[model samples]
Target: MTDWTPDIVAARFAEAAETARRLPPAKVQGYFNVWPTLLRMAPEQKPNDDERHFPPTPAAVERMLEAMRWMQMLDVDSRHIVWMRADHFEWSQIAKRAGSTVRTVQRRRNMALSQLTENLNEMRVVAASCK
Candidate 1:
């Protein structure tokens, strides 16, 4: 029910991108659905000795989990486009990666964001009326 401002959406998208990156390469793949939501898809394995050195934070973990919840509610194409964009991929790269044209990828991303905004607004309205 939090206000679905642009800042909130941007923060959550960034969080989701990080979470998707840390996803143990397993959850990120569609092989497993990881029930009740994708929130539990947080990385369980430690980074390899050759990988990055930073440690993870509890708040970061929670933020990623929260981001995944909204992501799970979105359609697959939209979610893929949004996450790819958040991870700093170019539209052309995303299109190639998705096997979609750049225009198609851009359209999907916009639709995904719009859907997310509408869903969040509905949640806000319901929450406000309940208060």
Candidate 2:
């Protein structure tokens, strides 16, 4: 396993966000359209302007899942801060949402990332020992 770092953790979170965006939308059960097909107007299809997005690779999805599991190690507030930063939200926006100063928000995010890095590195160490 590679040594974990705060930057690596942050990158993984960003990858997770992209992976999530590529996934299919969740369907709501018990929702059905009763309108007749003939009565509905067919929307114009723009073949050239199609915005098709391919699904994320299985490895990417697995990495996303691993990143999501890392969130469980953080406090709720830290999780939100980390996730928002991963989503490319500005520091000011995160601070405003968290009801804190930009410096504080940044500090908290850094600390949270550091904590995760430490945990990941320790896990790698333990795993290597067992091998």
Candidate 3:
């Protein structure tokens, strides 16, 4: 298996966040709400093997599917990047919430962003060169 870098994580997170933002408000809430259920349950392990075991709302399901597709396109790791993305956090508030300094939060945020952008750009360049 290939190693997943911070850039790959960030890019996926960004893509998912973008996809979520474009969706309707109800859909967004559904997407966020579904996470709990998804985290708590596995789709394949059940006595009935029922699809209904997935408790996410219709909109949540839709967002998840869309995000999944987008993540594949970016060649990024969706699971790892969830926290780095803005959707899961307010960059400025993270420091205060943790009783840390704003500068620390900003630095981490910048480092993550830069890693993602650089990796993406490198891939683009490599692809262009190959073509």
Task: Identify the candidate with maximal lDDT.
Answer: 2
Residue pairs in steric clash, candidate 1? none
lDDT against the true structure, per candidate, is 0.73, 0.89, 0.53
Q: What would the TM-scores of all predictions be?
A: 0.66, 0.81, 0.38
lDDT tens digits by residue: candidate 3, 1-131: 24445566555556556555555445544346433544325655566444333333666557556545434434233223334444666655566554567676666555655655566567767877999
Clashes of 3: 0
The per-prediction CA RMSD against the true structure, in angstroms, equals: 9.3, 6.0, 13.7
Query: Looking at model 3, which ten-residue stretch has the lowest summed lDDT?
Result: 73-82
Q: Quick one: best TM-score, which candidate?
A: 2
Predict model 1's lDDT versus the native.
Answer: 0.73
Error of 3 at 36 (Å): 27
Deviating ranges (above 4 Å) for candidate 3: 1-15, 21-85, 88-92, 96-99
Worst 10 residues of 2 by lDDT: 36-45
Query: At residue 82, what lDDT does model 3 achieve?
Result: 38
**Model 1 C-alpha lDDT per residue in residues 14-129, reported as the tens digit of each score:** 87677556654434555775454222223654455434333346687788777778888797877888888888889899999889799988887777777787788888898889
